[model samples]
Target: MLQPKARKAASPSFTSDEKVKRSTFSLRLTKSKKEKHMSHDKTSLPNAGPSYKGQPASVAKEDGARRRARPQTEVPAVFRRSRDDYSRGEVKVSSFSSPVGSSVDHEEEEEDIYRDVDEIEREREWLVCGTGAAVSPGNTLSVAPEVDILDYCQVEWRGSTSSAKRMRKGYEAVSQRFISIRRVRGDNYCAVRATLFQALSQTLQLPDWLQNQDLMLLPEKLMAKCTWITEWQKLPAKAENWTEEMKACLLLLKRKWESISEKKTLAERQAACDALFRGEEEEYSLYEAVKFLMLNTAVQLYEDNQKGLEVPEFSWLLFARDTSSDPFQLMQNHLNPLGHTGGLEQVEMFLLAYALQHSIHVYRLYKHGTDEFLSLYPRLPEAGWPEVILITEDDRHYNIPVRMCEETSL
Candidate 1:
């Protein structure tokens, strides 16, 4: 939980008249009936300024009528899932929807019971960092649209606090190399979102890459080499269901890619990709689909190490079993859930880069200065230029970094 900011003491230089006016204004804003009424009818407030102290009566009446006529925004279908449905691990697999749909329909119950919880969870998650408040309760994860890095950090840079200085300095460092940042929501899926957004978007932009069936089948290849169906079934009762779920998720990815690949023009493909990411169910399914590949990679690494076969030095250590930790258990606890477990670590990021056969270059920023600001996963010279460019302020959360020339690419 975040602590409330300490209030500053009033300056001794303030005159009694000024102090009295300030106190009176604050009291009026909170205690007055007119203010309370205005708060409920916010649309009536004039847009010319922040205050409604001197708005014309005629304009307010017109705005009020318009507000009354406006319909309430409908919640998306993906967010309407009940707690029970989510706990059962049932998901919508309709053509463009998520992986599987529940036979039981609860449309009435969905509108009545879970809507408020979902809204509260969404707002709470946005306010808190690194806290999986939304996903834990089975609410749909939200993604914020991309914004300029300068604009994203602008609010923090206005204060005289230490945090302000840190944010300002970090922005200055990033501004030198990047023009904008697409904030991948930090709800433990940041790594998956950032990687897919960059990698998939690049494929859409490049005709040669989109046309390559081998590239499209990369997930299947990873599964074959890493996850054996016979061995996977040995894992508890969940494995049987997971096998089916994994197949559905894999199909979801293929269909989405096929849909995007059908576009003849670069702009059309880009537009299709944008629409795909915007859908919560489709995006969540794709995120889960990638995790299967990640889990398979982890399993393969663990088995190879057990057999004394060569593996990446650091990558193998992450999944190396201890007295308390098993690689399979780690995957169940961390990879199965949407949020609250944890985001991908260094090993997984490297695995993703290798699994996708693309280099990932990340620009890192810190509170204080550092000798280096860039890190590349699977830093092989033979991999050539990075297909994904990312930025991180604290390293825990990752976002897409766009250069001035690459704005159109996003």
Candidate 2:
């Protein structure tokens, strides 16, 4: 008498008609949702490439035309928002027909919108590569395809020039030129390498070119170093015990890396009297040896505290910073980057600039010297000229730009 036991949950049975109505209701709702999704997604919807809901980008226009012929009451619920958006993002659908009172009704349009929103929220993702671009999960945003051309380019350039801006311009011109000449695109580096050899046969395939040319004379007279296959494609030295030559190459190559700040010219640089590389009599270490080579030969740097001994390579050369473009790796990868000696940086840039703009002419290299080198590179307006001039014992470090008027180029 106190309490009735909990009764079993009642199972309500329905007649065939009620069952059929419920099934119909669910089927319409699902179809309405799918149509709503296909309509809103402009990418997947074919003719909607321009803009129309519920139509593939291909047939969207035709479907839209047919939609216009129907009455407002006849217009499906899946298309209302897109049709309404006619005044906005989509193309105007003028003189459209009446909305149709379908099984789903106009409410299906809202359902589709909500369906798309739900999918986007569920699938979205992104990543941070420093402060650069992000990758979204949806195919809605286009992927910026990268341009690669390594085939026609077996060589890499590495250097800092007198002017960074001119150097950057030079690289862009070079990249554009090479891309055209090699016909490199997609997965065509292999073809590029083959074509590069064919087009630049003198540089890549001429067996006799470097045999008679001096490394120094080529830059002076040929506007090029004998472009030959590097003896060891893979270097022989290891990092722990890199050869003096290897160390020379790496430090020389270091100027190719990207950095945050612009560099100062010799005039703006703090005065230094140090010998960065040469160690004292008893304390000579391998690290010091590497440092000495890097400072005096590669980067052309002297110590900040003590130095009167002249390092011939570093003697009158300016230490330049290489900061050319976004994804700074492009130039080093594609162009012949650095010239070996410090004094040749501007000359290399000048030659690279010419090559970037036109097919290389050997005669351009010989006509002038330092005077020609100064005229082409990138620089701040105020950084005067170089003190360098023709072959003489009195070579100095003054900013006398290579010019006909100044005799610096002579």
Candidate 3:
């Protein structure tokens, strides 16, 4: 090598020391190429793509790998817009495609707007009822027109008879009891009597024979007259109770059964029977007529007590016995004495008589299924009344035409 020192190759020869160095450099270059190929493959990956290209080639890429997975929806760039004068927040158009002021009709955008609005709404329905799902009232719409529920309502009816008296009386009665808790109690004596008679008359279902009679024949006020009822209630209950005179008046009541029992021992029933034949015109008087029946029946009862020839004995005498009272005493002494026709029937009649005397309000409904019916409707503003509406089957609306009152019978 010393002899050839002058012959050093320009590119360097394969000398022992030089060859080792050359081989090491070749190895390093090969390794570097392999690393470059790996980096290129990484950049070509489906996700980890796009290596930084604008940098020194000697150095490996320094940019970090993609991290966020979500699609970026950056706001549009701030462009000169008319709405800018009244806008808020920073606008970024990094990804926004539409121009700030441009009129771009996009189906995607329209769909998005509708979607957002639908998500925010609280009420939504898919109705398939009434009118074959064509109408929209009772169901609200947002975009164009709102369906009106009032338009779809249908309540069909009409009025027949307009009852003024009933309306007035009802209003008065209801007014009196508007604040009252009792089913039908009244502070006014007149009101109470009116109410009671109203109830009684309805119960009795009195025929015209009794109902049409003159009410003033009695010296004292009587229940037969509607107005008289109000006055009658004013009299103390003690005064109305039977007195000795009153008891005497009802004497025929005691003798009624006596004649049926002891016939032979008793006076003839002819006197009483004859009186009945005589008093066809209400002339003999209630007191005298009753007395005549008593005298005839008294003898009859005395005779029946000794003989038991009639039907099976009834024990009504235990509850209805009244031997001590003479006429009633016959039934009491004889456990099988005949009794009155029917207590319930008589009581009902009396109650009816009581009712006709009181009620100021009366409705004369037709008998035997007549079409005549009283219809009630709520009052209207045209009727010159306040806001009181009564809706009935007759389908008429009116103000509170009738005030309510405390009623004994309704």
Candidate 4:
């Protein structure tokens, strides 16, 4: 062979582009040589070695044998797993390849997160408001149907020393027969709630019609029974000029009441009534209805009590009217059951007392100074009266334990 020309030593110095090209070519050449060698070696290998075909089967068999070798125990299907199961990371990657699977997984995760959030929110509401089922989508009232009056009322005893002594003496005298004191909330419905609590406690079975009835509808029901309270009856004989507006209001109220009574659902009825009360023209109708109900109901109860038509202890209607108040005129002002500050007037209290009749005794407690305590007894007192008592302080009312009688009756 002609002596190979002296191979020039490879030069290290080169342009950047040229250097890159040379390196690439060298890598390709080396890869090709290695592949050729590997192919030749594979071809020359003996066929007597272990066959890959049987190797997979043997491995699978061995795995099955190992699994069977272990003692089996009963485990819930949810907790059970096989060696073939993919890890969470692998499953996540696979989920990405399948659109439906990915969407389903995402939805499941979202549901889990929502469930956790709902649980946390429910706990927070219970702790903060102390109300169960306080929030609902369509229900308006936040109050629970069954509530413990004592849970909401706060008690503070304050009075003069002499008053306290007097209260103590009264308590000692009544201690032998006195039951306990109960309190209620101080809203317009306070009197109603207080009186009802006493009545319900005494009655072995509440009237089916009254049992599930909304307390707010009492005025409306009473209005239905007493229709003579319209403006015609209330207006002065000389001032009986029939205004078109007044006639229209009376007609509208009649139709509204009919619609309300026809509504099948409580929510529907409440919404209809609310709408009527909200209307500027019809708003007065609600006031008139409630006023007449209060006046007539009170008068009826008073008359009934006088006639002894029913026993005082079992009567469900009782009212003691003020000596100098005009019942019809009283209805013109402060007859709003929806009002926050207006409904707790003496008139409303009288109405509630009349409704409760002799079912319960109301004890009005007063605290004038540091150590003075006074208890005002109910107007009607009869033998074997129910033991329920409600206390009022600064117009705030609540139920208290009968056993904790510090200062009693006056």
Candidate 5:
């Protein structure tokens, strides 16, 4: 009867409260079950990441032991080498798989040394022989040797039967006054040397700065004087008016003249001159410098002698109609060395003669025929002057050897 009364009247509010509590309890139980299931699933999954809160004690202890076992101060020896030691190969580098190191072979580095030495020797041999080595398209080396131009020519002395017989017809027609005929070295500089030698021999007779040296030293001394003159002419005010070609000529003259002056022996000086002629030691051709120097020296002498007298037109007369012609070019053809063309013109010769204040008598002896001797008198005997006799051969080649006579009395 009491239960029937309670059931009928669990008051509406109390009944609702009981129902709410029951629902809350049921929800809490379901949530707790779900949370436990999720935790079990995470533990069973193999690919699940590490969990900090759920980590095992054994695994944490193992990591701490590994950290303690490592040596913090110990490093490999290979990493301790200095930069210079590495560069010089003092320290050996090893392959990652190899424990022991090996060094580079020095013998392999020196293999080409002997080959380089042999090549240098071969080059020296070629240079001494006056030959150049040419490399062909086939990778073959060939040498071309230069021939001495004088080797093919015949030389004759004055008054010899061979000379007299060859000149029999023209013997009386030419002046027979020279004392001797001497052969000179045939090369690019022969004409210049011969002319210079003759000029020096005559000029040395007069009292000048170059009067004290022996005849053997005359050439070098004359070169020094000429070099000094060239230097003096190169002063700022004077050189400003010179063309580039003229300046180049002057530079070549100075270089060659300096080289000759520096040599202590005649052989050395001769070698230097030879080098200059062959274009071995100089960049500029020597012939132009020689021609320019000769003309300049002659002009200087003429001006010195004429002092106050009205000087005649020398350079202008040499290149008439070509008023703009370079004086250096007018003196000689300097472009080609092997070619026997280009020399002082007649006007230049006359100027040289006038500068010398002497008569230049050239007697050319023949190598071929009966009318072998031809005489050239630059200025006639009526002009009272010092005499310079130049003896030459029939060959019109400018490089032929020539000699100045000991006695030039005609």
Candidate 6:
């Protein structure tokens, strides 16, 4: 329950539709005259999904501009199932017969290995307060220790059955390709925390990249890209005030980056990285920076569609999910709030991949199988440099997967 406070909506002054100019990019605010309509339900998937058992409910196929149509109430295929099942922490398993010799004691032992998703709500009282120590603020980030998937299945599925074992077989196949599975906290912020952990960890290890100013300048670049974002950020209608807020955010980002990137030794850098992620203030501040970047990315896409230019296929996901074409609403309802039940969904992840200029590969495992579940945001042809690798079993929470033979601890 130790989560960041919700970010309040900026005042009405920030929502003004006016033209503003800045050095890097031009900013123009024009209200959309297009009547609010739901975006196409079908979003482009990197590849088709695997058939479950014999009932092959493959992912929606691609059509012109849109992917394929689904129910308006249902979320995109990439993230819907887990949210449906895991959000309430209910474990729904297949009715398949139990494996031979499966014992109650064995089930209990396996359950001990993994924490139930439902237990998260009561976590702070035990993990934080019960220890009788001054606990830091923000969600906790555990050390990424390598875990075996077959063992994971025992607890993940609870009572092992033929279906569970078959599912394990599929994961075993994937585990061969992606070796280390590092479990992350199962809170709503799982997606953001997992992705950033991979990104920042990569930045810290690259000696040639430590001095990369582009990473440092990312905030400014995003602001420039979506010049009208200042309005939604709710700065008073003064241009000067907006600029000041931008500067403040930038300064904060720089300070945090330097603390991690400036360390002379690997051990020192790793420690600094740990501190930043584990500390409440640093963790929350970084999330705010990321929220800004995502907001800009969404707005930029919205701008392109407004201009009558053909946006990329991924734009369907954004427009469809946010039918109103209102970036401010997306910010207020989805991105700004902290510790909300749902964190960043696939739509936001796609935007973040573009916003951060990093590819995010999410490996997913469904109830029956794990084939073709690997999703590359933006669906890049080749792995983007500084790629972040993560996996989700239930689709609701994400965990980092260290590639095979990689010495990286995270």
Candidate with top TM-score is 6
Q: Taking the tens digit of each residue's C-alpha lDDT, what string does model 6 give over 42-145?
A: 12223111100110112221111111223234333221122222222232321221221223333222212234333322443433311111122443543345
Model 1 segments more than 4 A misplaced: 1-143, 161-163, 204-241, 261-269, 321-326, 338-340, 381-386, 403-410
TM-score of each prediction = 0.55, 0.16, 0.13, 0.31, 0.32, 0.57
Model 1 lDDT per residue over 1-410, tens place: 55643322221111112101111100001110111211111111111111111101121111111111222222221111232332232423112111111122333232122124454345445432222323323423233455677876664246555545665776766664556666555545667777777666555433343346654465455444434232221112322555555566666776776676667764565466667765355676676667666665665565665566777653443433121023444344345433333455444456777655566766555423543345556654233433676766544567776533211211
lDDT string for model 5 (1-410, tens) is 23321111111110011101111100000000111111111111111111111101221111110001111222111111232332232432211111111222343122112124444344334331111111123322111112222222211123345444454323222222221233333322333444544433333134222233342233344444333223222212323433444555545544445546666654455444444433232322333444444555543433343354433344333322121022222222221111121223234444555543545444443422322232222423324455554444332212222221122222
- Pitting candidate 3 against candidate 6, the one with the higher lDDT is 6
Q: Write the per-residue lDDT of candidate 3 for residues 1-410, one digit (tens) a residue.
A: 23322211122111111101111100000000111111111101012111111111222212222222333222222212222211221222112122111232342232122123332121113221211111124422111111221111111101132332333333323233222111111101112222222222122233232233332122222212122112111111222432322233333222332332233321233233323322122211222223222322332232343243231111111111112112222212211111100011111111222222221211111110221122111100123211111111111101111212222422
Model 2 Cα lDDT, one tens digit per residue, 1-410? 44533322222111111100110100011001122212111111111011111101111111111111111112122211221221122332211111211133454443223124443233223321211112234422111112232221222112233232333333332232223121111110111111111222112122221133332232122111212212111223434432343344433322211110122332111111012111121111222222222222221112211144443221122211111111111112111111100112221222222222112111011112222221222221112221111110011001111111111111
Clashes of each: 5, 45, 42, 16, 1, 3
Model 5 Cα shift for residue 236 (angstroms): 22
- Once model 2 is optimally superposed onto the true structure by TM-score, how far is the C-alpha of residue 128 displaced, in angstroms? 18
Local distance difference test values of all predictions, in order? 0.44, 0.20, 0.20, 0.30, 0.30, 0.45
RMSD (CA, Å), each prediction? 20.1, 35.4, 53.5, 42.5, 51.4, 18.0
Clashing pairs in 1: 91-100, 92-98, 92-100, 93-99, 93-100
